[model samples]
Target: MAENPVKIEKKKKKKGLSYLWIFLIGVPIGVILAVLDVDMGFLDVYSLSDFVAIFILFYVGVFLTINLHELGHLLFGKLLGYQFLMFRAGIFSIQKENGKLRFSIIKNVGYGGLCAMIPDEDATMKEYAVYSLGGIIMNLLTGGLFLYLSAFMEPGSIWKMAAILTGGASILLGIVNGFPFFSMNQPTDGMMFFSILRNSPMAERFYESSLLTKKLSSGIRPRDLDLLKDFENIGDMHDLTKAFYLYFQEMDKGNRDSAEEYLLDVEKNLHKVPPYSLPAYYYELLFFALLSGNLEKAKVYHEKAGKILMKDQDINGLRVKAYYAYIMEKDAEKARTLAQKGLAMRDHYPFKGQALYEEELLKELLQKIETERQGQ
Candidate 1:
C-alpha cells in the first residue's frame, strides 16, 4: 500500500502542569491542619513535625488512590465483557501470561496508570461510557465516603487525619481525572468518553484500532483480519497500525519486495508514530532488510533498535541479533548462543502469538546453521 503525503494535525502546546500532581501534593496539607489541632480559621500553631507527618501520609494516600482508580477500570471493564490484557498502576504492571497474571515493573516517571481492555465485537457508546466512567465514579464515591466518615471522628485524632487525607486525595483524583483534558499530548478517560458521547469520528476510529491491535496480538492472522479502512481524518497511531498489519500480510504471502516497499513507506512516515512505538518499527525494518539481503541497512537498523531494546530486552531482538551474527559477521558460536537463548525463553516473549512467521524463520535459520556446521 502506497501512502500519499498528508497534513499532520498540529497539537496545541499544553501550558500547565497536570492537576494530578497538584492534587496529590495539596491534599496532604489540609490533612495536616486537622491533625495538629489547628483549625482552618487560624493555622499559626502547627509544628514542623506535623508537616513531616503530612508529607509521609500524602504518599500513602496517593498510592491507595492510584490503585483504587486503576482497580475501578479493571473491574468495570471486566464486568462489561471486555477481555483484560493488562493492569498497570504507576510503574508496576500485571500482564496475562499462560492464562495467569504476572507482575513486572517498568520505569514510568509520571503518576498515572492504565487498565488495557480488549474491545468486544458488540462494543458501542454504552460500553465506552461505562468503562471510561468507572475510574472517576470510583474516585468520587470512595472520596465522598471517606470524607463523610471522617466527620464522625473526634478532632485531632489520628483516624480523623488519615481519613481526611485519603478522602482529599481521592477527591482530587476524581476531579482531575474525571474532567476531560489532555495531558502530555494524550487524551484522558473523560476526553475519550466525551468524544464517544459527542459522536466524534476519531472516537470510532480509536475504538476500532484498539480492537484490531488486540486481535492481532492474540495471534489472529492477517488474512482473517479487517481493519483500518477509513482514510479520512486518520491519526498517526491508526496509520502505524495499518502499516504494521499490511506489512505483515505481505511478508506472510511471500511478497518480500512488496513488504520491503511498504516498510520503506512506513519509515518515511515514522515521525507520525509516538516515541514508544519506534522500537517495533526499527525491528520490522531490520527484519525486512535482512530478508532482502541488504546486510548494511540491516546493521544500521539493528543498532538503532538496540538502543531502545536495551531497556526492555525482547525475544525478537535477540533472534535478530543471532541472525546478524551468523549471516553478517559469520560468527557461528555467537549466533548459536543467542539463538539458543531466544528459543529457551518460551513464555517470556510478549508478542510471540502474533509473530508466528517470525518465530518460524528463526527456527529455520537455527536449523540451517546447524546443518552448515555439520557439513563443515
Candidate 2:
C-alpha cells in the first residue's frame, strides 16, 4: 500500500486536549457534587433510572448538536453562494437534486456528519476560510449562549441542567471537530482549515476531486469533462477519485488490460484510502477481478464489498452483485436481470460518470455471454 501522503502528525497534547479537558474537568465536578450531597433539584440523579435517563438524554443531545454543527456549515456556505452538494448526518444523506435537497438513508458505515459545498471557480482563500470555519463558529456561539443562560439559574433546576448539558455537548462537539485529528481517510475541520491555510496541494487536489465528483454525480461523463490538467499524485482522496475516473475511462474504451493495471495500482495503495471509501474500490476490484478471470480473488473482494453495499439504493452496487452472481455463482439469468436493472438506473445513478461506463461494460459482457451460450 502506498503510504498516506500526510504523516499521522504526532498527537500533540494541545491538538485534542479540549475534549479530554472538558471531560476531565466535567467528571470531577460531577463527582464532587454527588459527594457533597448537593441538592441540584431536577438535575440530581439518585437512582439507576436517573442514570439511564441522563445517558439517553446525552446521546440525543450529542446527536442533535453534531448535526447542528453540520447545519452551521451548510447555512453559512449557502449564504456565501456556495453550492450545497451534500449534507450527511451519520447514515442519512441529503443530496441536492433539481436545485432542491432530497434525503436518503444508507448503511451507517462512515464516521461523523458532513455538509459539503462547492465554491465558485474564482472563490478566494478568505472565502474558503470563512466557509471552512463556519461550523466551529456556530458551535461556539450556540454553546456559549446556552452556557450563559444556565449560569443565571439554580443548579438543580431542569432548565439549568438541560441548558448546561446541551451547551457542554455543543462546546465539546466543536472542540473535537475543530481540533486537528485524522480519521482513516479524512481530516477534522481544524486540520482541513489549517491545511488550506498552509496552501497544501492536497487540499486543492481534493477540491478538484470534489468538483469532478459533483459533475459526475450530476450525470456528466468523465470523458466529457474538459480539463487543463490530468490527475496526478497530489495525495488524499483525490487519488482514488482520479483512479476511478481513469479506470472507467479506460474500460469504456475496451482497454481491459490498462483498466486492470489501474485497479491493481489502487489495490496496492488502498491503505492510503479512507475506510468508508475502501468498500467502493473493493467493489470495483471485484468487478475487475472477475473481468480478468480471477474468480478466487473476485470472490474475496465481493465478500468484503458486500458488507457496505446497499442493494436497492445503490445502482452500481447492483451491478457488482450482478457480476458476482453470473461469474461466480453461474447464474446467468439472475445476472442478466440485474444488469438490465442497472442499465435502466444509469442516468439517475450517483457517480453517473462511472455508471455510464459500467453500463457499457455490462452490455458488452451480456453479449459475450450470449455468444458463449450459442456455441453450446
- Against the true structure, whose lDDT is highest? 2
Each model's total of backbone clashes? 0, 1
Residue 375, candidate 1: Cα error in Å is: 5.0
For candidate 2, write residues 172-267 as lDDT tens digits.
778767777665556767877887888987567656666776676667775676443254552555666677767766776777787777677677
Candidate achieving the largest TM-score: 2
Measured with C-alpha atoms, the lDDT of residue 273 in candidate 1 is: 62
Clashes of 2: 1
Give the TM-scores of the predictions, in the order they appear.
0.70, 0.73
Error of 2 at 29 (Å): 9.0
RMSD of 1: 6.7
TM-score of 1: 0.70
- Where model 1 places Cα greater than 4 Å from the true spot, the runs are 1-39, 109-111, 120-125, 152-154, 157-162, 217-219, 227-235, 254-353
RMSD of each: 6.7, 6.0
